[model samples]
Target: MSNPLQLEVERLLALGRTPEALAAGEAMASDWARQGQPLRALALCRVLLQLEPAHTRTPQLLADLYARPDAPAKGAPPAAAATLPRVPLFSQLGREPFMALLGALELRTFKAGQNLITEGEPGRSMFALADGQVDVVRLLEGGERRTLASMGEGEFFGEIALVSESPRLASVVATRHTVALELIRTRLERIALRYPAVGETVRTFYRERLLANVLRSNPVFTTLPPEQRQALARCFELRLVDAGTVIIEQGQKGDGLYLLLQGQCTPVLRHPDGKQSAFSSLREGDVFGEISLLLGQPASATVRAETPCHLLRLGRDAFEQNLASQPRVRAALMRLGTERLLHISKLLSGRAALEGDLRV
Candidate 1:
């Protein structure tokens, strides 16, 4: 720590201006880290301990600056506590914790046509748009990308990155010059260490937001009332699987209903005679395990993940409690099961015809 800067910060503490003292210390530390001087950064840590260890921002500040060797060089510029306007996304956070989280957010600027988040990339942070506009998009099986929504100021996206280590579910591109605040993954982890409730709130908020969207759009769930859908979303537990992992094996008992929220899967049909065939790929908004659940039979096919997947599973009891009363939902699900069964027949018939042609 530089003597002049250290002395000024100590003076603030002595004058009972504790918040000012922490701010000054944090700024000095940030500057030292930005300068890429490890010794100066380390010295500030000791000074923070001596001055006022109880309320020091040293841990978070140091973690932010030097946690990863490349963090200082590649990280976004730090944002002040009061930098962002009223963001409704953080509205769930209490005043004190929200302020703390706000201070951790970094300022990011993007030009028009810049990619904020890319589909299928590792996501370590989420963003809150402070100004300008962005488009959220998803990739289709046809190798085309579709805009899911256009967001302007006060909207936030990428919350799932904070909770799940899976790849990003979609991409966000700036439509114009944009200013946003980014809350990185590690900082949120540290904050969660200090504020458990804050961590739960964020995790819960992400889950509800993620699953609620699925429930609203899914045809089987659409017949249920909104409140029921929300309640049903809560009943479903999140499950993630890496590429090539078999979600359900052929001829096995189904767990319940699994709604694919992100990524793709392929249903592999294994015949008793040892031939295997993969049916069409299953993408977002596709649901599986329903055939077994609805008919009380073993799964008809093996489902394997084609990519890193995020899924929500409703257990047998929960599925019954939630959808058993809804006749339309059950009927719709039954129809889907019948269609899948027909698809299975068609695949088997195609393979048999190919074998017969080869014999001919």
Candidate 2:
């Protein structure tokens, strides 16, 4: 509440400018949404919606707040709220959301050597460990078991069930007598409908974790130091694009560097003969638009989503501030662009040779 936007909202309220205060508060809510403070964003959104129900951005804002992800949840940043800090999954929820979930949670007990969740079964709920220990295991394709992780008190698992009807990806077994709090998907989603800010909170946590994981594993980013990688992750904006969307146009300046998170994309170069040919396809974990962004030139190829795509974009201004300002990171990006360009050139040369033969 002490941030510039919060302060502005407070000052406007003090002056009895209720309409203006609500307006500024809405903007502050957006800041919270983007900064991994979803509960705060949700609380503010709820407040503004109540005050100005006709706000043009309500439906879309709420939809996005529920669906989109952002930077890592820092356990309530400046837009922080008083919330449960036990399970990292629900640790960032606002007071109302925490209370709503509290009512829906059921305490469950499991004896040692018992299954809490069996892999391949329908995932009906997610659980937060209240006491004791458990093991997370996955069934390998060869019929062997692989222990993925060990969970102790305050840890939670099986969250994807809350958002999707997907089957459980892994199994949880109690290593000892365990006490846990379970929230069924039916109940949890009821809260989502009632308080979409809760949706925003969950969305925030997901993106925060996802962005961190993606950056940590990205090929180019892996070369950067951990601290630098984290810094770069914070600057990225995750975007969703529909199939057939042209993200980068041939011969046009790229708006930013993009890292695909989901779906498929193709980079195609148009020849002088009014024909378009794909140079390569991009999939999850692939990076694009860097060559143009790094070299300060127009895009040499057009990149379009061949399937619905989720991507992380780092804008030019953000790049200048975080990546370009650091010599090592800048050089790494430059090297990547050079390597990709060389590959594209070879692909083009091969294509041209084939086309020339056909002309003969």
Q: What tens-digit string does per-residue lDDT give for candidate 1 at 1-360?
A: 124433543465575535566577667766765655433443444445555646445545544443322323235345432332323444455545554665567657687899999988988998876556899999989999999899976667888888776678788999977766678989999988887877877867777887888878888778888888888878888787889998988888998898888888988888778898766678887888888989899999999999888888899999989887789999988988887777677677763322221100
Error of 2 at 217 (Å): 1.8
Model 1 misplacement above 4 A: 1-91, 94-96, 137-146, 165-170, 347-360
Deviation of model 1 at 327, angstroms:
1.5
What are the candidates' C-alpha RMSDs?
A: 12.1, 15.1
Inter-residue clash pairs, candidate 2: 71-208, 72-208
Per-residue CA lDDT of model 2 for 42-91, tens digit only, reads 44444454456555453244333333234223342332322312336544
Kindly give the stretch of ten consecutive residues in candidate 1 with the minimal lDDT sum. 351-360
TM-score list, all predictions: 0.68, 0.58
In angstroms, give how far residue 121 of model 1 lies from its true place.
3.9
Which prediction has the highest TM-score against the true structure? Answer: 1
lDDT of all predictions = 0.71, 0.66
